[model samples]
Target: MIYRREIDGLRAAAVMPVILFHAGFSFFSGGFIGVDVFFVISGFLITSIILEEMRDGTFSLAAFYERRARRLLPALFLVVLCCLPFAWLWVMPEEFRAFSDSLIATSLSGANFLFWFKSGYFAPEAGEVPLLHIWSLAVEEQYYMFFPLLVMVMWKRKPSWMVAVLVAIACASLVYSEWASRVFPSANFYFLPSRAWEFLAGSICSLVQSKGQKRGSDPLSLLGFGMIAFSVFYFDETSPIPSTLAVVPVIGAMLVLLYARQGTWVSALLSTRVFTMIGQISYSAYLWHQPLFAFARIRSIDPPPLIVMGALACLSLMLAYLSWRFVEQPFRRGERRLLPSTRSLVASVSLVLAAFITFGIYGHDTRGIPWRLPAPIKEFMADNDWSKTCLLEGSSGWDAMPIENCIFNGSHAQTYAILGDSLASSLTPALTKRLDGMNIGLQQITHSFCAPVADVSMVPHQARDCGAFNAAAIEYLVKSKVKTVFLAASWKIFFEQSRYIFNGEEVATSDVGQRLRDAFDKTVGALTSAGIRVIIVYPHPRGDTEIAAKVAKLMHKGTPAPTITIAQDEFLQQSSPSYAYLDDPKDRHVLRVDPAKIFCGREAGRCDLARDGKTFISDKVHFTSAGAEAVADEILVALRQDDIMDGNGVAALSSD
Candidate 1:
């Protein structure tokens, strides 16, 4: 196959936006479309190469795979190896284990599947994974594994029929992508089945170009650039990508491949020295950028400053240039041989695979090398069992009820209900302890991200039926005739943020806030009408710091812990909106509890996250076991003061 300088320029176009977007630039919100562009480009170039080899009757699957290994593995393995030391030093144990899992998966060309099971591509946790970008490479490699064989089997057929076959498969893949984006978004984004259509678009472009078709200097190439530019500028995290909307950039790339020929201005622009140079190193640049950004994020206490991230982006380019000149060029040209023969490439890959597989097993079996940290830090870092057992997740709704070992004093006549998202779930440990041996039964109904407010939709994360889940919990509470109900959530996230991802779209916080208020009003009204007392737990003091990690870092350094506090005024200001709906003068049965008031001193005007040398909050918001106990003690005191519970521990309502 001939070299296309214009193609290299297109690569530069694809990589820059991705780098910028990952660097947290708002302008590059739709910059992720660059991956889609790369998909189309790969489809075109790889198909073109395969067709040329088939026409010459010299195609061999082994030779094709060897070339792929030579082109991809050297730089990729170099990046992964380089990331190890930093991951060991900076990443916490569980996260490091996940990184090890990704390393093993990447070596086997299965990172896409590993990541699909882990989290969404755009999730905040993805920013901490050094090898997260490898998923795309894995997707491409998986496609090529079967794609070449399928092409060779059809090579003897008429060209038009082959193109028709490609088109048909592309259509089927696109339909699947559209449906999957709605139903299983992470799978749609990470998997090859939903993504193959983009590559097939390029395959069709290759077929058209092979037929010697030409529309000389036509303006369609310019239109193609415009469409790509539109997607790059306008698309965002909320876009249901790889769906029909992805057609814009896929078609744009197709147009460029088919029409941006010699003498066309688009081709001339792409062939410019600067664009060509960046394009030349685009592969190395892509390999280098993510690790640099991810490490920077992982090592920071707060989000790295924009200037610092900008500097890191420049450093990534410099590193990419060096790798391209040293690592990539030598290996591609076989000037510096890592293996003596072509067949040795397989041996080298196998060795690397075995090493990573072993590392993954050790990492998992040892639970992320727990000996690396002090026992206290390791204990703190470990996920509390309550998170899994007490918290209900997914679309199962109320079917996850009757959480064994969760319901306490079940045989007692007096029943108290705890309801809300994970914040409410955190209360279970403390609530169960407080009511122990008190002859009071507890019904805990908790779902992560599903607030107890009725008829409000949680965006991007929760199912659309979250409102239905809340309604069901409410019905269960009423039917069970629970005497008191407690509700909590990370309300600041919903009411204070400027925007939120909802149903694969960004919605204004104001809109969701209004809906929340409406739901809260209706929910409270229903509970009060049913003669059940309602306790609305106000937002707790929180900061941007990860308290557990911060404490661990302090312990690692063998230094006295630094004070971690959030100003009470700031906390109140942030949480004020959470209670605004309760200002209605007619509201009677609902009572509010401010945890900050009990947790922090009025004179200090700040809430301390660490008390007597132990971290109270786990992350930014959820309470630690001790912290929950403290809050629960205060709640019990309030219950007694309000006469909701009598001196004998029976509900005051027993006489009503």
Candidate 2:
């Protein structure tokens, strides 16, 4: 195949937005479509190459694979090598193992399937791994493995019938993508079958361009570029992806490829040195950017500022250029005189096998660190032995347990009902400490992922479990003499446009606020009318980055012990703008607490190792047994202010 500067220009078009978007630049939200564009381009170019070779009877499976290895492996191996020191130093034992396995998966060209089963592409866990982007490369490599053979067979049997076979395969891939996107979104996003249609779109372009007719005039190419530009700016992460909606980018890419011939303005513009330079190093740029961003976030426990992110982008480009020049170009020279094809193939296969063997054998054993803890902190985390604690009914089952477990157990314990979602459950260890110390009996009930926001407008997934669990818990409260009901959960997840109705009704537009207020009133009234007081518990401030990153940093530092810390007021300030989506519901019945002041450090605004010479928390969010005991003073103050707790803990105690 002859070189086309326009093709390189097209590459620039596809990759720049992807780099920008992944860099956390808001202007290129839809830039993720760049992957789809690349898929199409790969399909067209590779298919064209295969078809030409097959026509002349020069197509050999060995040769095809060699070319692919030359094109892909050199740069990829270099990337994995560069990540070694960082993975060793910065990543935790568990994460290091996962990264090692991902490295093997990438080398074997099966990373796509591995990632699909492991985590969603957008998942914080998956995003943290340096090799996450290798899934796309795996998809392409897997495609080449089968596609060349299929084309060769069909072309030999019937020269004119290959198109029909490819069309059928493309259709099948599209169907799989559409179905899987709904059922297994993570799988749908990563796998080759779901992604093949985009490539097939490009393959069809190869057939079209080969027919000796130009696609259209300059107007069509300009229109295509316009459509692509619009999509890149407007689309976002929330958009249902790799589904029918993906046609926008696929179509735009086809148009640009088909009509971008010499002398056209579209071709002239895209073929410039600046754009062409970006295209040449596009592959390396894609590989380098994610790990850099992820590592920065892991180290800081916060995303870098835009200025810092921009600097990283510039650094990525420079690294990409170096990789392209030194690593990629040198390895791609298919000079059999120096390194025979057989030897090169054996070496590549050996490297791939070594990576796989090492990862598989060592993956699990990598995290075999011993758990040694100080006597006190160890007691706090593991106290109330799992064997002895009144294990709630159905806690082991898929069905949710009631909200009664949030209370304490004691002779004089008051009637305090606990309710909320998983966030609420995570807080149970801390809450239990305070209530247990106070000699209070507790009844805790909670449903997984079901935050206790009464407003339908706030809830997401319109989760049936939330509605059912709350309804049953309310019924229990109405029948019992519960004096005070304590409500706690991750409130931010619910109170936003993120709400999705399972019933399929669009959010009620005119009365959304009123409806929210009414729901709150009904929820509160059900308890209060039954002579029960209500206490709303807001969550401690949290960083948006994955929690594992924070834990891993401590592990890397070889800490003698774990520490508990609260986010600073300044950190809270940084997060507050996102909270406009979360409307805080503070009523006379609701008692709010900003524990950061008492729990966090004075200067850093972080939860300190010790507060006033007293250890306040065990970990970042959960309070230590001692910390929980200390919080009894604050809990009492809030309860007294709300007049929910009586002089004696009798009514509350009896209710429990």
Candidate 3:
């Protein structure tokens, strides 16, 4: 197979946007499309090579795999090995364990599956993952594992039959991708089944070229360039990718491969010195960029400034160039003699495999090596107790009948319900204990990210059946004749933002807020009409710092604790709309509980995240056990003062 200078230039085009986007440049929001571009290019080149080998009757699976190992493993292994020391020095125990898991997964070509279970590609914590980009490589490698054999079996057939088969497969993949992007989006993004069509698009191009198709016109080449540029600039995180919209870039890449021949403007420009050079080191550049940016984020107290991130991008390119020159080229040419024989290559791979497997076991068994940090820091880093089993998860729609565990003191005659998102779930530990002691039964009906509002839908990041979940909870509360319903959520998240991503498009926050307000009114009216009391719990104070993690970092550094705070004025200003809607003194059945006053007093001027050497806010919003207890105390006081509970702290039930 001959080298194509223009293909290398195209590689440069694919990589730079990804690096810039990951570096926090807001303008290149659609830079993630670069991965799609890479998939197409890989398919075209690999298929071209395979088809040529088959034509010459020299195709051998062993030779193909050996070449693949030589090309991919050296630089990848180096990158992972370089990450270890820094990971030990900086990463927390939980994250380090996750990193170790990724190391093993990447080695086995299963990183894509691992991440699919863990998180979405564009999630907030994704930036903290150094090896997240390896998912794409895993996808391609997994495809190649079966693709070559299939091609070999079909190579003897007529050209038309082969094309039809390939087209059929690609069409099935595209249809699945479209449906999955709407339903199981993270899996669609990370997994190969939904993404195989992009590669097949390139494979089709290779097949066409092999059948003596005419070169695409110069105008077609220019049009292909425009389409790719349009996608790079216009698409964003909200785009429903791997769907029909993705066909634009896939077709663009196909056009370039088929049409942009020698002397064409697209070919001449791509074959330029600068583009060709970056393309040459593109693989190393992709590998190097993520770790540098991720580590920088991990070490920083706040998000690194644009200038700092920009400098790190430059540093990644420099390192990539060095890696390509020394590590990648030497091994490819066998000049370094690292894998001079097939047996040596196998031995090296086995050693790497054993090392990563051992490390993974150690990390998993030791629980991220907690002994590395001081006891205080370790304790601080531990997850909140409420996350263990109290939170309801997994089901998107409401159960036909409530799970037995969801109802506490099932034998008791009188029941009260607690409802909302995780905020309400966190209050369970304190609320259940108090109610149990008083011989009053409690039923917890909480869904994560599902606000207990009627007929309102949250953003796509939440569960799809959130509106249904909320409706079911409301119906259950009314039908079961619960004495009181407690409502809680991170209300400001919906009302304060300018916009949110919903069903793969941006919707105005104001519209969502109005919907929430309408739902709140209808829900409250229904509950009150059914003769149940409604207690609307206001949101707790949130801070910019992740208090527990910051405290742990401070202890690790042996530095004096710095005060973590959020301005009371800012909190009030942001949450005022929610408070105004929920807190209506004129409504006889509705009682409002303001825990913010207890959490953030005006005398203090700002909310203090830590009290008496203990962190209060476990994460940004949800409370620690102690914090939950404090808020529950405030609720208890409010209930007694409002005559909803007796002097003995038992519920003032009508039956009693």
Best by lDDT: 3
lDDT tens digits by residue: candidate 3, 1-656: 87888899889889999999999998888888989999999999999999999989999999999888888888998999899988888788767888888987998899999998887788887988999999999998998898898798888666458778889999999999999987777889998999999999989988998889746478998888778888989999999888989999889988888888888999998899999999999999999999999999888767889999999999988999999988888778845556788998899888998898789778877868877766667766774324433466546435764645778876677777888788788787777777776676788887887677775656554545566777777887787768788888777764554544443355676567555566678888888789888888886787654566665666666755655677888988878887776764335666677777666763567877766446667767777777777777777776666674333532222110
- Clash number for each model: 0, 26, 0
What pairs collide in candidate 3?
none
lDDT of 3: 0.80
- Model 2 misplaced stretches (Cα beyond 4 Å): 24-30, 60-66, 92-129, 145-194, 214-249, 263-278, 300-311, 329-331, 337-417, 452-485, 497-534, 546-633, 639-656
**lDDT per residue (tens digit) for residues 40-74 in model 2:** 99999998898788768788898878777777877
C-alpha RMSD for every candidate: 5.7, 6.8, 5.8
Distance (Å) between predicted and true CA of 423, model 1? 3.1
* Error in Å for residue 421 of model 3: 4.9
Model 3: worst 10 consecutive residues (lDDT sum): 647-656
Model 1, poorest ten-residue lDDT window? 647-656
Tell me the TM-score of model 3.
0.81
Q: TM-score for each prediction?
A: 0.80, 0.71, 0.81
